[model samples]
Target: MTFEQLSDMIAVVENDTFLEAAETLNISQSTLSKKIIKLERELNVKLFDRSKRKASLTEAGRIFYEEACRLNQDYFEMLTRLKPYQGNRRQRLCIGTLPILTQYNLTARLKLFTEQNTWIDFSFEETEEAQLLVGLRQKKYDYIIARENLFSKLGCVSVPLAEDELMAVLPENHRLCSCSSVKLTDLYDEKFILMNAYTSIHQLCIQILKDAGITPEIVRTGRVESIISGVAVGEGISLLAKSNFRIFQAGQVKVVPLDPPTKLSVVLAKLAGTAQTDAMRIFADYMCNGCEV
Candidate 1:
């Protein structure tokens, strides 16, 4: 009926003597006899034949003994699986970032952390600025990294990672490609490919243009690659983070620094007041060190 009673039954059958079984179980022979009696009464079946001096199993007793052994094994396995969660030794980490980080292969740097910590399962999500903030607030993601100012009103804690300098991607034959650095004012009359206005980078570009006292002719609004491909074809020049330089082919575009330089701070943001788990701390450290560009 109970696990202890089932165990006693097994010991009695295995040892073939009530006194020996009681000694093995560290209980008195009378106590073991009562437990076995209780189990037999609960099942309404005879477990052992007392006609002989040594105990012998009934057909029903053999079946119940096999089943109890299996149940005991399964219970141990379940306990092993549950121990980690019970002891706070296991963790699940969800990291979120903007597309720019993925394009630059930032996740590869976390390889060591993943390999070293076998008990922690990790997943990465790439999202836009607004969606990333929403996920962090909803507790769907543990951390997010994006262009600096994106977390301004998101009520999250932001840590600066690096200063990402904005650069101009110019075609090899473009006139400004010869200049070591291009000023924002020089692009006033130039055709430009811009990211969608809804993006944080696009908003930063708009601010930079405003500061330079010029309005760029918006050729199109789309992703970084699309803009870079347009620039490669001489359709229009575009501004991009220096990290994106690796995505463009060597001959396709020339990366020229901005004159009177403008830069955006790269930041890692997390839900405010969220406990900093070991996995989160390792990831943050990896990002801060691995993001050399």
Candidate 2:
């Protein structure tokens, strides 16, 4: 009911152990347990699944936790808006992105927009795509930049930014490296170390392999940077956006084209059917039309 209880419940979910969560909250285990029991009694729903050694959230608990997070986000935004009314503090826009998106020269590209609109203060968070969507829906961010194909159903207005050319990364000494370029079929039998499935590019690459009637022997999963590191060490091969070649050091890895290459469009998105702030509108216009605000 109270933010304190909601926060404690979230901490329980985060720390995985009730005792650890209690420690994190600087409360005794008995007090933490009492707070949770009171919350469940008020809500009339079981919150945690205690059967497992490590405490985990029940279905209803997950939903409640998300709402609790949204409540906190909205509260902070309200305080931020109120500050400008009380003082000379400037309102700023918050943007979220997948960490690897930074490899695409996003900082330099954003610099132009910042130069023209010096008054528009900006902050950025690098997180996973799913977390970005959750934050976007809760209005934690004015907009987020991510792969275009992943967010169509979030009820957000998406504007395509640029197409990312997909490429295969291989160890410098890999047999596939002998060829000028490799085909998807060529990798059919190879041990694949791929990007985490949370990435749109990962889903696209998986489908590509599936469509070709080729099932890559997946050895592991990781972020783009981690996947690249694995490939460089001959741990396995991976597919990623071409923009990363220059950004990531490739001392022991080789970037090669897929015979039937593919591309994923990066997009900027804002919650649909909502009034856009002046800052948000200017950013949308600049990214989509290249027109000065």
TM-score against truth, every candidate: 0.64, 0.62
Model 1: pairs clashing at backbone N, Cα or C within 3 Å: none
On residues 1-293, what C-alpha lDDT tens digit does candidate 1 reach at each position?
Answer: 66777678778878958899999999999999988888889999998887987678889999999998888767655654564466567778998888766445666666666765556788888878778878988999998878777777767787776677889888889888899999888888888898888888788888889889988788898887788888888898888888776665545888899998887887888978888986687667667776654
Q: How much is the lDDT of residue 56 in candidate 1? A: 84
Candidate 2, lDDT over the whole model: 0.79
Tens digits of per-residue lDDT, candidate 2, 95-133, equal: 888765556556776777776655568877988878988
> What lDDT does the true structure give each of the candidates?
0.80, 0.79
* Candidate 1 C-alpha error for residue 98, in Å: 1.6
Candidate 1: how many backbone clashes? Answer: 0
What is the clash count for each candidate, in the order shown?
0, 0
